[model samples]
Target: MGSASLWARTRGPSQKAHTAEITSGGIWTVAPQLEQERAVTGGGYSTPVGVTRAEPEVNVPHPQVDAVARRAQERVADAIEQLKDYLAIPAISCEAEHADDVRCLATKVRDDLSAMGLQHARVLELDDALPIVAADWLGAGRDKPTVLIYGHLDLQPVAGEEWSTPPHEATVVGQRLYARGSADDMGGWVSHMVSLGAWLAETGTLPCNVRLVIEGEEEIGSPNLERFMDAYPEAFEADAMVLTDCENPSDAVPGLTVSLRGLLEVELHVRALSSDVHSGLWGGMVPDVSTSLILLLARLLDDDGRLAVGRVEVDEARRAAGADVPLTPEIIREGAHLLEGVEPLPLRGTSAAEWMWWQPAISVVATTLPTPAIKKNALRQEASATLSVRLAPDQTAEEMMAVLRSVLLTDPPGGVQVELRADGWAGEGWLYTPKGPAFEAADRAYVRAWGRPLVQVGVGGSIPFVALFGRRFGDLPLILNGVMDPLTTAHGPNESMHLGIFGKAVLANVYLLDELGALGRDGIRS
Candidate 1:
């Protein structure tokens, strides 16, 4: 699909257009084009603070990263060469045709991780389910905390006809890389591998006792993760988990995601008659089930777009913890481009910051119905709808689902057979009270790496695993960080990351290890 008209105009300048001289490791001269644009627009640029100048002594500037970048640069040809081979083997977990391919991908990933210095890296085979790849590096003693990292290797189902480029081909044009899994996760996974390689190559040991777990069922709602977690509780027990799944709020504001909205998804199916009656024959006499279902679904939210369900409410106490910071109206307005010409949703008559951080919203994500053209002159027998209830930290998934089902079932429009099938995944929201050593170390590292202090924000999306990890290791100081920009189109087509932002991410991760050590040595251990 073509980009939005506004996005086409605001695609922004290329790196060369933004900077004149690109330095290797540290400081580099700003491009004249970018300087002029900044001067005219009065928008400041953020560069990694002290690293503008090169530091040549200690590390090799991570040759692995260079090699990876070179490989990425040749993505077009590589994608072409690998296209048929990849697409021919469907890896859809839901389908039997692709099961073997899924297993193969798991093995390939484990082998890659193993080559990246984790000699013992291997995949954990879950019976009757996709496998999860795990690796461990115990560089530190038990006195030091272990950092568990999580990611996934699965891709959503891709029908053959829906593309201009090959589905499995890691195609690159100019600077944009295109592929089925390139952006959703595969690219991100590759980045972690490269980063790990860089750290191992330079330090010969990880900064902490680390465990890496990458599952293949994330896109499938992680059907087996919790079961696996239950079977082996100690496998992922760690001080922190670095989830690379999320995105940074904006390129300028490198943020630490403070919270993720809980998810409550359900499909409400309404069935009227078993057989189709011609709409022409039954025009005025019969009640259209699709119409009734639509009307009922419309009442789910108030005029303000907030969920009218009783369970979806803000937690004042938790809200006060992060409270709304300085997110501006202009930022929210610009971000609502997802709605195109439609006006932005009224978020409880509050500032974008407050609404995003403290409010719950209900979205009718999808409703399935036969084509109007295919409609017989029949009273529609059934129509099914899906709703995504994004809950605030105060709400529970069970409570939200209960409220939703009750509201729909309470008053049905007469003869329609409304069967609300509350089926979908529910992951709880999290609000961590940042304190003690890990937070302090992370804060210091972020501040030192970038000139600005870390901005904590709540994301509209959920990881589903963070809450699980939190429950597994109560009171563990979990830190979250990432480099994907807010408008990076992560799950959507044309997903890309800012190179400069990624470089800063690497520097941040590198310093984070040292900061953690400092925190431990200075008596912050609990």
Candidate 2:
């Protein structure tokens, strides 16, 4: 499907007109036709920010940014093409068979980075882990800040997902480039690559020292990122870091990620009988494990389908920040691809940002419950469901598990052998408070590039690598930004990155380098 399908208009009490733009903080206005033309052209270029935006929201233009922006614009097509080359490999990290593909992509990136005049561009290997690609250029000298850029090359598994376009072919429909890794990551770092490439090509050097670290297994929750970090500490040394795996609030408004929810998976197993029992014969006499399982799961949720137990109260400051996020029901409906007549769970006096980014949520990801293929009028011996929990920011696995166990283990419907076990991957959440000259530098850079200062935002999903970065280098400024919008559909089928976002992101990176470099190491360090 194309933009026509992705942005299909819906008229109802829950959704607004599809043609709307969120220009002000937390406010939306009906968009004119001119706003639609502020998108990508066939050549993968964007309408100049000056022309599309009518007037600048923040004008902090610098002499260096002007030249860098031009060079970056000239190479937007190359960046798009480079992203396609990388996305085609299908370097899925979760499957055993695709291990070689991950290695191949890592090597290709290493060589390509080497070609960009970076020093020591090579693939890093660990005994039992996938590879990571690294390179750096520090010739800008010690006085300038060293900026480390992070992104992942691995992709979510697409074997069972339906796609409108070929998942790996990198198709461009409407204004987006549709591919598995287009926005989630490849586009993120590729924009940096193009920015760095332009700096090297136009002036023969970057404004600041730069290091590139591309992980090969992020989609698998970055299980070995800490191991890679431990084994190669020097590769991570930087005065500041630009974590490129994040989202913009809107394609029109850039977002600086300030928080991320954690992930924890738990499995619930119910067993009442050793063998299958005919449901009709034992309908009322026996306590069916399947029915018991359904009831227990229901107990964990509220009428709106949110996790009822262990909900956290938000402070006024955070609650106000959440209110400033333009997460109207229309945006949520379009972004989530909800079917007609199906509405998002009621907000229930909470802002979407607060509910999604700060509070806890749960979903049943997998279960041993029978399907039609195994249909029989009988109760199976046991049933299990693997629940994926999105924990509150700053919450730990142990804390959420304790709360879950307290509710799930007490008062069984049939007194069946109920077992609640922590299962699958688990990671802690991160909450950061950005302050310093570095954030000021970032705001200047974004203002020049996007005509507006960066808006603070939080992600609902867990990024293990991000928490690792926060834990390891909390003292340094961590500027998280990327080329994703609500419609990116990352980790899901039909994933795409808006080409306009890609183009603007490259310029933002260009300005970011100049602004950070001007701050000098000493100024940034404090």
Candidate 3:
């Protein structure tokens, strides 16, 4: 399909040329040709600290970088073969039984890094936790900035029956590669490795110092990341970071993620009696735990699907940031892959994109009760459910959890006892504004590789480690880009990665590193 057709199919109808200007809150407004040139030359981009320079511009034209990247693109077949070997390992970190597989993948990654000529490549062993691979190349002097690349080596579990091809075996159909981790993350890891390998093969040294932190526990909400960070603070220090685990809005246009929603997992349990009681014997006299839990859950949302626990207000800055992003019902339908009979929720006084990316939302992830197959007619002794809440940028997990706890405990259903407990893996939301030299360099790199302006967007999902990195690095520019497109079907059946986009992403990273190196040479701080 043509790029325009694919974009329309994936992101709804196209908007006017002026609409793009409104989406960014007026931070970027220029003619098409001038905008592309400014993005390439860093002419009109602003820095947060207001530091300006008139030094000689380091210009590596698109053709020069593309030539080097084309050499790497020539090896796409080899890269795919190696990726198949990597994907063959069932590195599901959520299940304890797959711990060995996770370690195997970590060792493989470390070996690959070593083969790439990195000076230091080893796995950091955490006590009772999956191993994390940490590698660095300090060939570039301290005068140059060090760039950290972050990705995950683990993946979600797979069901064999649900997939058209074997999830663990990389199967290529047309231009797409089908595998468990092909798009969600292994594609990201491979992209980094390919770029670095290409640079090292073409030239003996990299443009800047590099460090990699590939973790094995990210699929499980990164439960051990905090412990890892606390234990070794100096290992992760870098001047800038590029997290290679996000999805593009469409196949034609690359997206740079600017924000991620925070996550809070909660479990609510209620008990009315010590044991299951006969409903017919005491149907009128005894309290129903199921009914009580149902009533409590009903209070969680009002008629409009807004959370009723407390007022959900959007941040002024975030609202402006998402103002002109076109998110029609058709767009949501295509993006979400809604079933034929499934209808979307009513408009909640905001665009669907704004509601999804900038506002708070709740979903009852799972519920536990007696199965109808067992034919149980007794009143259940206890009822429980799992609630997952996605918090906006300005909201913290603790504050939202407090509001939910207050509402649940306000009034009891006569005799039923209620208990609410957090799942111990709360993650704060993260917001980043594109400014300074690093962001501009990334924008130029994206345009150079894709021939289009990069889309600054927000992700409704949460990556716990991104927020952790922000806290640890504190204002260091974070470039969030990835290879997966809208139709990659990450974390779902028949997950695949488009080879065309994957090759382009590798080329884009090559350009990104070159651009950042030029800025470092010019004495840019970030």
Candidate 4:
């Protein structure tokens, strides 16, 4: 077959080629065959290094290791099938027409959890909120540390034009798994299930007590999770919480997210006139709303792309998130896909790295305007633009919203009536210091599984529940480990999973349990 056809043909990782080598520098590199070709030819490729034992050949054939790896792969395939079934049920919380889809997905999750041999698995039913799937296995001991695993099962609505294939169908192309929720939470959630199954199949028991809480309304800003946290604090109290819904660094680096930026989405509306008037007669007399909107947005940031809000500092953010790293420029250009001939935007007089990880960003998500194709040669009287602001650490959504509103409306651009209001928000930042036995166990497991140094990083985007969970369970460390690459295009169309990393993720979780088991129950005792 031609290269194009081969690239188009979807195959599982077991069928793909691989190369394993221990470099003189002591990094054990495992390059999957599918990625090797791409890496040599400038395709996005990743080789997870130092996570496994040094080996000269790819696909180690030790019976016990091979058995465990094969079991993990099989579980991934089974979960892919399960994911396809789950995605087919469109549980769009934003749409009122698909309420049944939400329930159906909940029922499926409950059933899947039950099938995993957990002692108790049931949906946490609510009157108006989508039910949360709650499951737990205590095993034979009362002293075992109970680790709570959290993820969302619902997905955002999909549009046909936005996807290369049907977004709901789990399309396997080469070593990639493509679907709407395939990468976001569905894929991440299913990974937890499959990894648990591998542990069960290989050892006949989990490394420690496990409680799984998968929700259905996370995509809709998780308006009900805080209330749920309050009502069932007992169920949530645990040694640690494992969040698989966070972002990973670029494909090259393995990272544990230590912080996240908050979000504020606001709409600024401007009225230049009471009604549309003929441009020929009113062109010079009336101000244009579109022009005013652009000018207003421009004032939010200085020429250096830093927020101009009083007392809002972007340099501190850059320093906090480790903006002095080498991957800044490459990762930014790769992540943003800037227009051709457009240079990377500088952040506080530094490279894109400083701008991306450490700095705040203001993006115009959408603008309401009359279509020009049907233009009636009339001057627009009113217009609105939605702005998405990424707040730095230590900043509140309300504070940022107020600042944006004040800036947009405080000084009127002559001839325009302007108003600003908060449209949506995912509240502000958090920093995680992983302490106690659980964190030590996680560190050991990651090292044993991947043979690499665990790098601590900060996610620029928001995970709304991270901060909420911090307040609910004081002093308990939250472990933010995930497999979504920066270019994974999560929350967009044609999302995919890199099978190599997915397999490694399974091993990491398995080893995490093993390390925790060594800590005994009292180590995690609060």
lDDT of 3 by residue, 112-162 (tens): 899978867988888989988999887888777889899998999995449
What TM-scores do the predictions have? 0.74, 0.88, 0.83, 0.81
Give me the candidate number with maximum TM-score: 2
Looking at model 4, how many pairs of residues clash? 11
Q: Lowest summed-lDDT stretch of 10 residues in model 2?
A: 1-10
Per residue, candidate 2 scores C-alpha lDDT tens digits across 1-526 of 1122111111123322233332212123444544333321201222211122233233233345445556667677777888899999989999999999999999999998999788889899999899999999999998989999999999998988999999999999878899999998999999999989988877788888999999998998888899988999999999999999999878767788888999888999999998998899988899888888999999999887877998887877677767767788899999999999888888888799888899989999998888889779997889999999998997888888899889999988878888988865688898887777787777656654665566678899999889889989988999999998899999999999998788778877887898788788998766
**Global lDDT scores for all candidate models:** 0.58, 0.81, 0.74, 0.66
Residue pairs in steric clash, candidate 3?
A: none
| Candidate 1 residue-wise lDDT at 425 | 59
After superposition, the stretches of candidate 1 with alpha carbons farther than 4 Å from their true spots are 1-96, 160-167, 171-177, 187-189, 230-237, 271-282, 303-340, 353-358, 365-368, 414-417, 521-525
Model 4 weakest lDDT span, ten residues long: 1-10
Q: Each model's number of backbone clashes? A: 16, 0, 0, 11
Model 4 misplaced regions, further than 4 Å: 1-74, 303-334, 337-339, 347-353, 424-426
lDDT score, candidate 3:
0.74
Between prediction 1 and prediction 4, the one with superior lDDT is 4
Looking at candidate 4, what is the lDDT of residue 368?
82
RMSD of each: 8.3, 8.7, 7.5, 7.7
